[model samples]
Target: MEQIWDNNDWLESANHWVTKQLKLQKINSIGRLKPVSGWGLGHVLKQPTEQGDVYFKATAKLPLFSNEALLSRYLHSINMPTPEVLAIEETHQYQLTKDFGGGLAEDSSATLWADAFEQFAQLQLDSLSYLKDFNKQGCLNRPISDVAAQLQLLIEHPQLQSLLDSEIILATEKAIAKLSHNIDELSQLEIGETLVHGDLHIENVAMSDDQCIFFDWSDACISHPFIDGTYLYRMPDSQDKTQIIDAYLKPWKQHYQPQQVEQAWQLCEHVCYAHQAISYASMMLHLSPEARVELNTAFQNALSASLRSNRQTVKSTTCVRSKFCGMVSGILHTLSLIQIKAGEAL
Candidate 1:
């Protein structure tokens, strides 16, 4: 199987397509198209134009990864600060967007992280009204109601079964049953579903003045917003994420009390891990054998974490509150931030 970047004919055609799009926008290409990154998952290339660098990205065709170009434009239409899309070729899953500078640095202050979390939470809350539009635009619809069935399907999938040991498979099955019970309890809370970033972290965000420009919508979906909180709280280099968690929950305060919110979070804790496992299972279908070998460990880890969370008892409200503070505070820490090179759409 030839990778997209390795195909000479495709590369030539892609270059011509990029040049034509730039010319239509009255921009001239001043330098050769440079490959910034490429992998089995996706590919990124930079086109140096008179205006500056414009990026070209092609996301692999996958069940969970949506058509990012279309989704990003829709998000921008809904007033989300996404990167400016210059051109798009839906058939090839290709997108061209203007550069938005580097994302948050490794040494960014806690205040910045808190602000981002709060702002993104507000965005998630606001996105509830657009749930129908999100669904229409091909965003994955993985509601709590469908999770158990999805897990069962994956468990029965021959490909996935081949990757897991007998013990872990048994644990996963038991965990899925437990997860169904927990989902029923969570549904009683009536927490509205909203847009989940699916893969939220500091690297996917770029700050412009007071506005937070969030890119990389490939993993975005319409689900419970707290699923994103799990990904955000686990961002590298943060020893204590209570402030981050509190900041994320700030926008939801008007809707629920701290205890209610914490309970909902605990109930959905294992759900997020299960969701990751499902995502990886979908990816396995599209990956080559070599790539699948690389992904096997991550897939197993997600399943293991899901089972691990299932065995733990929910913490008391008092302990949960103590572990999480109400206010966001300022502090500095060194995060291993990925530098946004040539439109870090990856």
Candidate 2:
């Protein structure tokens, strides 16, 4: 197999690879192999075999490939709700696994979210003993220094200058500095480390009958388990956020005091916001000029909205400045971050 440089090449190579795999498996007919969107460094195609429907994922991102393969196997061994790895083409960084079909709908019920969170919490709790294994797989332990460094990169990025003025930039920096200080304090607190699905949004989860299967373990890491709750905070306002959080923490209560659980939850919420800001900033570095413009415009609009929301409570000049700084931080953290779509020209 040749190196896949872009989405077209990836699709072509993946089709050939899946076809060969189908033949080897003695599946005579193959269904339409459609590409799954929203992935940044991989090509995933849904494959229909005589046996059943499965998924083929191929990535040139070696770290992600290795992490997913190792972590999925570990999760499967523990009977977690993840797809079963059927085959691995290590030489080419491709893997075949059972497909769980389209994930929960965009408007999936609150009950579904609760169920997923419960299962995810259990997975996190059960995997604590295997932290050493996760470390061996090169999963990142997100220390305060690393998080701070990422924030610094985002602050220094050339692209940010185009979107924010000097005043806004300064305010944003102050807000980030405060966030960094908070993270430093949180880092000092003793917390359990476990397998965190670094990108556990609703889209990453799929439902098959009664089973909830999670895929896209590319961002899996050995970090504070609360990091996984970032997606829960991004859920639609219509859903009961309190109920979802309660369901997620219910399992942890078995081993932790209520106060400890709440503290971890609060720390994780802040970490999630900071992590998102850093991620978007990092992504900005790789994006094309056109994509950056789109993102910049979107970010500015969000920032403006946040500023309006802050004006009501901010009376004194000092309070206004503080609110402005927080507003900038919140805007960057909550921006509807985008990636170059799988098939779109980059």
Candidate 3:
């Protein structure tokens, strides 16, 4: 059978696949297969069962899904709170995993955030030994050189030039040049790296009893441990930010000097922002023209904000540039494909 694309098609396939994989006689009371957010290359189905709920994720991008499965198994073996992988259909490019209930509450208390951060710190500390394994699994290795290259590509992209005003573009280029020096400074730091949950927002976390379980490992990478904190700092309210950082840093205090940890944290935040902007730009190619324009504007705005911040930080000694610029080259290359498609349509 051909791979499914739409949710309706996946639902039809899942009825048979789930029955065969789980050995269920019939799918009794299957809940609505709603689309999950935050994934561009795949779709997730929340399949309910008498026993419990299981999630079925189908992706055309096999490597990302396969990596998630591999990382989940590794984390499970290490006693981290990752969902169980139930089945893998290599041919269809789908996988089933045991779901961990609803996500963390929107108005979650400070206590819950504290517990989550503590667990997050412990996960980073525990996974240090498996850095080599993570790299072998095709997780991104974001070195300073790679990051500088990505920024350079973005600065030169034709689409980027057309998107921003000439003056703004010139300012951005100057900021990137200055930021390059700061990136070099970061390359000299003696920081240890581990598996970074590239996207670590509260929506990706679930609270089970007293334990905080994390899901959605598609963006996992091998980078500085503090890379995960990039999203954490952005998710909390301004008043709660200090507490969240303190909780996350409490466990690492024994392993790293306060200044070293703080430096890593700052660098990782900018890296994460740049990475996110690049990802959004890349995703624009897959969207409809109307959707593409909307997202393009958003990406442009975000890029402007990042450039402005970079300009300010470029004057400071603590400025650290991220290697997300490497991804920007690929995104820029896709502009030709988009142009070709547009010509064909005309």
Error of 2 at 129 (Å): 2.1
**Residue runs of model 2 more than 4 Å from their true location after superposition:** 1-9, 29-32, 36-41, 59-70, 163-168, 235-239, 287-346
Residue 46, model 3: Cα distance from true site in angstroms:
2.0
Error of 2 at 263 (Å): 1.9
Q: lDDT per residue, candidate 3, 21-116, as tens digits?
A: 766444353554455632445568776777677777765343222356555656776677877677767555566777777578757877677778
TM-score of each: 0.85, 0.74, 0.76
lDDT of 1 by residue, 1-346 (tens): 3345556687788899999999998999987789988767788899998889999888777777887877877887777877888888877778898998757874577777788888898898889888889877658787878888898899889888988998998888877777888788778777889998887777788988788888888888888777776565334546446677778888787777766787777777777888888888888867778778878898898888778766652443335545544322211111213334424666
Q: What is the lDDT of candidate 2?
A: 0.64
- Summed backbone clashes in each candidate are 0, 0, 4
* lDDT of each residue in 160-240, candidate 2, tens digit only: 766677775665555555556556655665667778887786788888778778887866777778878866755555547
Q: Which model, 1 or 2, shows the larger TM-score?
A: 1
The collision pairs in model 3 are: 147-323, 150-325, 150-326, 151-325
Q: What is the C-alpha lDDT of each candidate?
A: 0.78, 0.64, 0.65
Using alpha carbons, what is the TM-score of model 2? 0.74
